[model samples]
Target chain A: MQPFIQFESVSKSFGSMTVIDSLDLTIHKGEFLSLLGPSGSGKTTILMMLAGFERPTRGTITLDGMRIDQLPPHRREMGVVFQNYALFPHMTVAENVAFPLEMKRLPRHEIARKVARALDMVRLGSLKNRRPSQLSGGQQQRVALTRALVFEPRVILMDEPLGALDKQLREHMQLEIRELHKRLGLTIVFVTHDQSEALTMSDRIAVFNAGKIEQIDSPHAIYDTPRTRFVAQFIGETNLIEADVVNVQNGHATIALGADLAAKVRSGPELQAGQKALFSLRPERMRLGAEPAGDNSLGMTITDCIYHGDHMRVQLARGNFTFTARCERLAGDWTVGTQVVVSFDPRDCTVLTS
Target chain B: MSRASARERMGALLLIVPLLAFLAVFFLWPLWTMVRASVVDNTVSRVLPRTAAAIVSWDGQGLPPAQVHKALIEDLRQAEDQQALGETVRRLNSAVSGFRTLLTRTTNAVRDETNSGAIDLGDLDRRWKEPRFWLALREAVPPYTDRNLLAAVDMKRDAGGAIVSEDPGASANRLIMFRTFLVAAIVTLACATIGLPYAMLAAAVTGWKRTVLLLAVLVPLWTSLLVRTTAWFVLLQNEGLINGALQVLGITDGPLPLIFNRVGVVIAMTHVLLPFMVLPIYSVLLSVPRNLMQAAASMGAGPLRAFWRVLLPLSLPGLMSGSLLVYMVAIGYYITPALVGGANDQMISSVIAFYALGTANWGLAGALGVILLLVTMILYFIYGRLSKSPQLLGA
Candidate 1:
């Protein structure tokens, strides 16, 4: 099927500065795609371009095979949830929801029925007469969501919609939004700087770095097999070590860390003999013991041991590199200042390049 | 109430004592004095107390009884002895046109004669035989009458205690009052129409542009009212820059009648009051979140619809306050109208000034002032109630 929205060679520049450069992306219908990055990574600019709030300095954006780059924001037929909800303070919840319908010049009775149904969807029906100021933060967010959806726009854009809520409420709202997206089968493009939010809510996450997509994949694949050094460090905690490729074979290579330390990692085309490359090892994948059991193992001195409720974080140092390893409490305690062998399976380690 | 709370309340009251005293002495006292002066017709009763008392019961159809005549003669002799007859004559003359000369002629003829019954007052001045003169005296007899208040509205009570419009030959105060309100309303409307968009632009901009716009609005407020009015006077004159520019542009074949007219008055007043309208509106517009407009657009509203549906209602309180400020100030404006307006375009404030300083009719001035004050107070009361809502105060 053709992509629901297509961004073709889009670039945005402000005077002497470039915010986005030669970017291309596609969003599928009924998919919850998240653009996740740190601040100033041009993720918001892409979202703004898609919502028709900002125009690209070069190239075009198309919605379902129609060019929408020149369209004004009101004519774009896209619903957007702002970070602060942006509910009209002068209007009540129902009035705010009815505003888009009224702009469309729908019949008053149909508008009222739709407004009531939209409020009921957000469970804010009783607050139809209460102004935005009277509602709590979460309720206001629901009202804003209801308003954005009440007009039945084909696509929804959320720009850090849960950024203002507390952690507990943020998680709750994320689940609620995901449930709504699934039930309605509405295409959504969500932008957030929080990696965990992207992980928890999106069907697919596009990691952004410095005006480019670092990687795009499912949350499991993104966390398990990050393609670049930036992505490996950005998404989750990992132990990275610079190693020289000693030998390359079919689909795998042996990497030498320091003297007497060698590990097998999945190899990329950039990994050649006697060349330096970074290897990413998950903290939870490594185990501490006196004897090595996995395909790859290394001898290290335990520098520190931190007691977490579920697992102990064991810090190991070997030849100018420290690795953090999460050891389950079921595993026997390893004291600090003791030498141990840390081991991981070859399938769990991936080689990353700059 | 508990003693401690009561004592605390007393402390609060004590803290406000100086301000309350200041307001009473400076504001309320003057207002009370104006109200009293508007109705206090004491000159006639004070000078001719017996005659004033006698005429209250007299049928106004004919001349007052002989007893009233005798009392008036006694009062006139007493007033002449004290050298106070001139004041009474002047006061009575204001009510009826020729009373001062008539009273002076009769008093001069009767002053030296000791027999109050021997002299025929009608022979000295046949005008005394007319009951209209007596009716005028009776009109002024009451210590407090609505004559000044009625005259303020261009109406007065006739001899039969019926309210009637004052003589049309005299100046019509009601027309002046109507013109004052109309001019104020027009100036207010002009200020809102021009200032609203200017304020929105100023509020919507940022950096040096906003600063420049704000300074442009505020700098004019520092200039003296007289200087500004004079500036308009120079610009709007027939031979001045505006007419010269118009002629140069070939918009008119000759100089337009711009100065000393209603148009000039409204333009100058609107310029002066525009800042009052703009500042409040700018502050309100600044407080409105920019995201709301974006939300409106994202929800399928055009720019105008967003402004109308979300922004305008939010800024209404500011507009209301600005309108009230412009209107109240415009109605009481004196210098600008005096400099730029013609005789026919002069507002009620000019009339008040003419009555108070030009003709020394303080009672009439005080009456017109009371009316203006009452109208302003009523408007302020309504505004206060309407703005008591916290939503109007904003989030």
Candidate 2:
């Protein structure tokens, strides 16, 4: 099936600074896509360009096989929700939700019906007469969502729509919005700098770095197998240690950390020998026992232990390098300043050279 | 209160003292004095003396008795025969004052002692049934007659005190003030309509476009009202640039009579006050988020529709503020209309000046002034109430 929307070699710049650089992305219909990045990493810019507030410096944006880059935002038939809700300040909640219908000049009765249905969808039907000001932050966000959804547009674009709410309400709104997206099967393009929100809400996340798509995939794949060093360092808690590839043998590359410790890393691609590589590993994948485990082994002293609610994080020190290990079941109580052996399976460490 | 908050509050109060002083002395005191002047007859001097027998004595409860009114009318007539309209113009013209002319009827007509075009009934001592004295006495009613207000409108109700045609030949009603107010309302509405879009457009534009539009709105602001009015004068005067251009373009054979007219006054006033319209609206529009427009645009409404639905409604506050500012300024405008408008287009401020400076009838001037101030205050209040809820400007 044709992709719902495609950004083909799309790039955007503001004066000397580039916001989006030759980005290529495909948003499938009925799919929830999250554009995730740091604050200035062009994720919101991409969403804005897609929503037609900003145009790409070069290249075409196609919606369902036809070019939509030249179309003005209103004619594109996409619903948008802003961070601050952008509810019409002068209008009541019902009037704000009824605005698009009024613009379409729908019959008053149908507008009333649709407005009721939309407000009820967001669980705000009873408070329809109240202005957006009288509503709480979460309620205002729900009103904005209903406003966007009322017109039944083809796609819904949300730019940090839940950023204004507190954590509890934000989490609740996330679930509610996700359920709404599913029920409507509306193609959603959500932009946010919060990685957890993107992970919780998106079917596919496009991780942005320096005005380009560093990697785009399911959240699990993006976290477990990062294509670039920037993506690997950005997604979740990671321990990236610089090392030189000593040798490649039997599909596993041995990386030499120092004169004392040499470890072999397993990654998807066949890595060549003597190349400088960054080894990325999740702290949970390591075993904190005083024994060797396969070809990946290291000696270190226990520097510190952090008792997180779910697990204990053990900090290990070896030479000039420090690494963390998550030991779920603490075995043989180990104190700080105790010498120990930290072992890990070679397959857990992925190598990204750039 | 904490020391800093206290100091800041004190500083605010101190800063406000000058504004309060300015308003109290210049705006409020004059209004009070004008109201005082309208009620008390102090033609002898600015004092009520023990020799109240010489005054135009009237019972504030009912009406003046016939004898006191007789003395008052004879005294005023003797003063009119002496050509003493007021103390100031008596001192102003060295040549015109000494000579006598047919001014008693004009003075009586303007003062409401006689109905418009009605011959003066000379003696109030006669019986009330005598038609002549009865007509004049009937015209002169109570402690405070709205005679000055009528003179301002150039209407004098006849002996019955009902609004009637002043004369078969003389146009009883002025109709100029109504025309002036209509013109002012038109200018205000025009400014709001033309300026609202520019404000919205400026809000959307950024960097160079925004700076350019701001400069466009502000260029007339920086120029003095007189300079702008004069520029209009130069352009509007016959055989001046506009008519010259029209003639050169073969649009007309004769120079258009554009100067010293209502059209010229309106055009010049609009040019002078467009920035007033733009600034309030621009400030309000600037504070409005662009995302609102984007959100509305993305919500399946076309750009114009979204603007009408979302943007314009939100911008009503700015429009109201701008119109109020422009109208207030326009109503009190003196120099622009004086330079550009004809006799028929002079507003209340000009008439107030005429009474104050030309005739030096400070009593009449003060009365007109109180009316203008009262109307302006009322207009301001009505505008505030209509703009929105009071909380908008932190009332």
Instruction: Give me the candidate number with maximum TM-score.
Output: 1
State the weakest 10-residue window (summed lDDT) of model 1 chain B. B78-87
Supply the TM-score for candidate 1: 0.87
Residue B208 CA error for candidate 2 (Å)?
A: 4.7
RMSD of each: 4.4, 7.3
Tell me the spans in candidate 1 whose CA falls farther than 4 Å from its real position: A258-261, A289-292, A296-314, A318-320, A327-341, B1-28, B44-85, B92-143, B386-388, B391-394
lDDT for residue A204 in candidate 2, whole number 0-100 = 94
Best by DockQ: 1
- lDDT by residue for model 1 (A47-114), tens: 89988889999999999999999999999989999999988888888888999999899999999999
Per lDDT, the best of the predicted structures is 1
The digit string of per-residue lDDT tens for model 2 on A119-141 reads 88788999999887788899989
Q: Lowest summed lDDT over 10 consecutive residues: which window, candidate 1 chain A?
A: A327-336
